[model samples]
Target: MRIGINLLNLSQDRFGGVEQYITNLIGHMADSGENLTLFLFLKRKLKNVFPQHEKIKTIRFRKVMDSADVYDAIKKCKLDLWFCPLHRSYLPSVPVPTVATIHDVLHTEYPDFVPGGLEENNRYYGQYTASFDAVITVSDFSKSTIARQLSIPEKKIHVIPLNAPAIFDQAPAKITMKGVKQKYQLPDSYAIYPSSYNPHKNHLNLLKAILILREKYNTTIPLVLTGYADKSNGVYQSVLQFIRERSLEKQVWVLGYVPPEEMPSLYWNSSFLVFPSLYEGFGIPLVEAFKTKTPIVCSNKGSIPEITDHAALYFNPENPKEIALKMMELLNPLTRKQLSEKSSLRSRHFSWKKTASETLKVFRSVTRN
Candidate 1:
């Protein structure tokens, strides 16, 4: 089977989840020993992102390749299937069956976070998805949302869960952890939230919960945040403003965009994971915590509950008090130990190899039709 993967939408370290998803999926697929020939279509600058494999071929284009160029490339590949791992493809029409992974319908579900609101969300996510032969999503929640919001049949949208990056599985050496701790100026004991500064990530409410912990409970829980933060992002700016206004400078440490290699150390050293996001198609950090045997205290919203299942202590994301209470609960040694055990056990349920195998099934099924 010949499969073409569209990786043009990704840039190095920019798209956290989608980028991880594609790279992991391809890695597993190439190593799966299946009778498959994979063609990767990406910008020339990103050619080195995926390692060389006998089953994989790279088709690079200039950074400025437009829609026509993309379409022409797909046509020339003459693939049995074309897989767009992120939402939609640039090609208007392709020579082969198409499958797209629409991670979430967050734009339509929460237009407030999206710029230009519903009109813009619809323009990007609404009509374009319908053109694909099949849609892939990370969770049942996302599958349903994509179906209802986009008016695509539920049967057409496949639910394939995601796993944490393989890097999280290996325990970081004590010396390495010491180095990461010193490099980031990490607290001796702190909660970690690894998410980009998107409004839907709800960093503001998490900060409020931290403040509540200090004022109401008289408990000061240090927090270490990891993900992209930039001056240009209004949401990140708002998070900074909230931290300043609440005097949470001491309690909160923003270690923006920690490298993938250093993440395991952060997880190993953290007291527990705190995820107060308002939305997620699939919470990768939850699994990361599970893989590291780190307890989780997270929001009971979107696909979070589905992904985390009983491994985490759930709290309403909109209620800072509830979030604070959960955080407080997780601080107990017994509670943390118990959840950590569950976290370890639950980590067994997901793997990149499984994701790749199921995805290959999707490719074969689509191509057969």
Candidate 2:
């Protein structure tokens, strides 16, 4: 079977989780040992992003290429099925059956977090999801949200949980804590929150929690933040402003956009993972923490509870006091040890290979119809 993957929406290191999902899914699919030919439709600049695989064919187009041009190229492939890993549909129509991975319905659920608000989100996400033959999402929460918010049938949406990047499995062995600490100027021990500075990520609340920990409990907990910290982004600017206003420069270290290979070291050396995001389709960082046996204190909202289950100590993301309390609880060595063991057991439940197998089944089923 020939399957075309629409990856034009991605750029190297730009989209944190979405990019990881697409690249890892493709890598596993290529190595799945299935008799399948994969056609990748991506920008010319991303030619070297994906590894050279015998079963994969690259169809590169310039970044300036319009929808019509992209459609024309996809049509030429004569594929049995087309998969759009990212949420939105890039093409109006395709010759073959189409499947799209809608990671979340965050835009509609939390309009304030989105840039142009409801109307803009509806324009991009509302109309196009139903056009696909099948929809894939990261969690049951996301699947239900997509179904209800977009008016798509629940039966049409498949919930496939995501795994941590394959790098984490081997990263600890390769990375040195001393080197990673020196390179990033990280404190001896700190909670790591690996997420971009999006408004919905609730970075402000996390920082506020840090301040509360210091002022109320007189306990100083160092925090190391990783992900894209674009200076132009208002959320990022606001986080910096909060850190400065509260005199949290010493307690908080913002390490923007750490390399993927080095992430495991950060987790390995950290006291615990602190995820204060108000929303997530499926919190990938939680899984990463699970894989690394790193204890986690995260928001109870969204797919977090669904994903972490018994592996994490939960807190209300909107409440700085609750978040601070959870952080204090995680500092207990006994609590951390128990959660770490649970995390190891939970990590066994997810893998990229399983994700690839199930995804391939969806492709075959769609094409066969």
Candidate 3:
């Protein structure tokens, strides 16, 4: 079968979980003896994970301005199915079968955090997905969220959990770790929280918890924040102000965006991983922590509990005291060792090969119908 992968919405600057999802899925499918074609923006660079295969073809465009362009492209390719891994597609209609992955309905769930609010969300998740033959989600909780919010049948959504990037599964070489530490000027011992500065990410609460850890609990482990920090956003500005007003400049290190190759070393060298987000689709970082055997302290909200499955300590994200208490609780050597073992075991349950296999099943089912 000829399968077409649409990557029109991929941004040049931002390479987050969604980009990883598409790359892993396509890379695995390319090796699965299936005919595949990728339709991406003209100057965007895909990672080295993609292998050369005779079955794989790529078509590039400067930009897709409207549905007619996408529709015409697919018609010319004569593909049996089209897949939009980014939850939305430009085409209003397709000649053959089509599937889209709905990562989350966070826009409608937390309208305040989203840029365009509910109206734009309505177009993306509602109208765009309604045109597809099938929809895929990262977790059961997300599947239900999309089904209920978009008014689609539960059976129409496929739940496929995301795995950590392959690098997370391997131990970084000692020399590489040392270089990464020196290159980024990382702390000797610190907790890492890898996420963007979004309101729903709850960086403010994490900052509050850090203050309590330092002042109330006498904990000295600093925080290492790594992700794309949007200086344009007020939330990012607020976090900076909070750090300054509380005199936390020395206690917190905001390492804007780290390269993918440096992540495993960063996670391995950290004391632990802390994720205090108010909501998430699948919590990919939780799995990354599991793979690296990094003990975790995260919120008991959204799909976090569903994904972690008792592998890590949980706290109420809104309560800074609770977050601080969990942070202290995991500081014990015995507790950290035990939880890290459980995390390693839990990490075994997810893999990119399995994700690709399950996705292919959905594609066959959709096209056959």
The parts of candidate 1 lying over 4 Å away from their true place are: 13-15, 63-66, 123-126
Clashing pairs in 3: none
Cα lDDT tens digits, model 1, 1-369, are 888888777777565888889889999999999998899987788747888899999988887446777777666877788888865454656777888888987878788886778787777665566667888889999998888888889988989999999888789999999999999888899999999988899988888899998998999999998888777989888888888998889889988888889999999999999999999999899999999999999999999999988888999999999999999998799999999999999999999999999998888787883
The residue ranges of model 2 lying beyond 4 angstroms of the native Cα positions read 13-15
Error of 3 at 297 (Å): 0.6
TM-score of 3: 0.94
Which is the better candidate, 1 or 3, if ranked by TM-score? 1
The numbered model that scores best in lDDT is: 1
Candidate 2: the clashing residue pairs are 227-257
Each model's lDDT comes to 0.87, 0.86, 0.84
Worst lDDT 10-window in candidate 3: 40-49
lDDT of 2 by residue, 42-109 (tens): 78888578889999999887764467777777778878898888755457667778889889878887
Residues 44-134 of candidate 3: C-alpha lDDT, one tens digit per residue: 3544434566666766665555557667778788888888787555466677888888888888789878878888877666556667788
lDDT of 2 at 326: 91
> Clash number for model 3?
0
Candidate with more favorable, higher TM-score: 2 or 3: 2
